[model samples]
Target: MEDDVRDDALDLLAEVLVWRLAGDRWRAVERALDGLAAAGGDTDAFREVLHDLELAGPARAVRIEDVAVLPVPEPVRERINQLVHTLEGPGRAEDDPE
Candidate 1:
C-alpha cells in the first residue's frame, strides 16, 4: 500500500513536470503539486522528480514534445524544440532557457 502511494506520488510529479515543460502554466503545476502533497506525498521529492525529469534529456524531451504541440506559446514551443535538439546532440545546453 505504501509502495502504491509512492508510485502514485511519483506519477503525479512526472505529470506535473510534463505539463509545466509543455507550457500548461505555473499555477496549474503548483496547484496539482500542492494537491498531491496534501495527499501525504513529499513535496520535496516531487520537486526532485521534476528536476530529474529536466536532466533526463532523451526520454523526458520526447514526452515534452509530444505534449508541447497543443496551443502553447511560441516561445514555449521553441524552448521544447531546443531541448529536444539538445537531447539529440545538435544543440548545446547554453541555448536552453534557465
Candidate 2:
C-alpha cells in the first residue's frame, strides 16, 4: 500500500480503536468507518488492522502516553473527554461481572 493510504488506514484504525476503548462513541465510529470506506481502496491494510483490533480483547488501559503518539486529527479531539471518561469511568469492562 502507498504511504498516504497506509496513514489514512492507520488513522481510521486508531479512531475505531479509540471508539472501542471509549465504549460506544457511535457518531465517531460512523464517521471513522465512513472515512475508511472512502480511502480503503484495494488495500487490505485497514482490514488487517481491524482484525487485530478484534482479536485484542477488551481494552485494559488507554494511557495518555499511548494516545499522545498518534497523529489524531483536531476535530476528533473534541470528543476525547468523553472517550477518556469511558476509559476511566464506571462503564469500563472491569466494572462488569460479565
Candidate 3:
C-alpha cells in the first residue's frame, strides 16, 4: 500500500481503537460491575474478557504497510484479513495471534 493509504488506515484504526477507552473511565465501569458476580450474571465469570480496549501509555503511530510488510507469507496475509474482519465485530485479539 502507498504511504498515504497506510497513514489513512492507521489514523482510522487509532480512532476506532481508542474510542470510549481511557483508564479512568473504564475503572469506573469495572467498579459498576462490582456486584455482577454476586448477582449471578453469567458474564461476571469473564468480565475482563468483555473489555474492548485496554489502558495504555503514550500512543505510537504504526502504519498498515509497516505491519503488512509485503514479504509476509500467504498464511499471515490471510490471518491479517481474518483479523481485520474480526475487529469489525469488536472481536478477540492477541499480539500477532495466529
lDDT string, candidate 2, 20-90, tens digits: 33333344444544443343345675555445444433356666644433333444544333333322444
Flag regions of model 2 displaced more than 4 Å: 19-25, 40-98
Mark the regions of model 1 whose C-alpha exceeds 4 Å error after superposition: 20-25, 41-98
Per-residue lDDT of model 1, residues 23-45, tens digit only: 33443444443443343336466
CA displacement after TM-score superposition, residue 83 of candidate 1 (Å)? 24
In order, the Cα lDDT scores of the candidates are 0.42, 0.43, 0.35
Ranking by TM-score: 1, 2, 3
lDDT of 3 by residue, 1-98 (tens): 23443344334334433333334443433442333223322443323322322222123554444343223234333433543443433333343354
Q: How does candidate 3 score on lDDT?
A: 0.35
Of models 1 and 3, which has the larger lDDT?
Answer: 1
lDDT of 3 at 88: 39
Q: What's the residue-level lDDT of 75 in candidate 2?
A: 47
TM-scores, all models, native as reference: 0.30, 0.25, 0.23
**Candidate 3 residue-wise lDDT at 6:** 32
Best by TM-score: 1
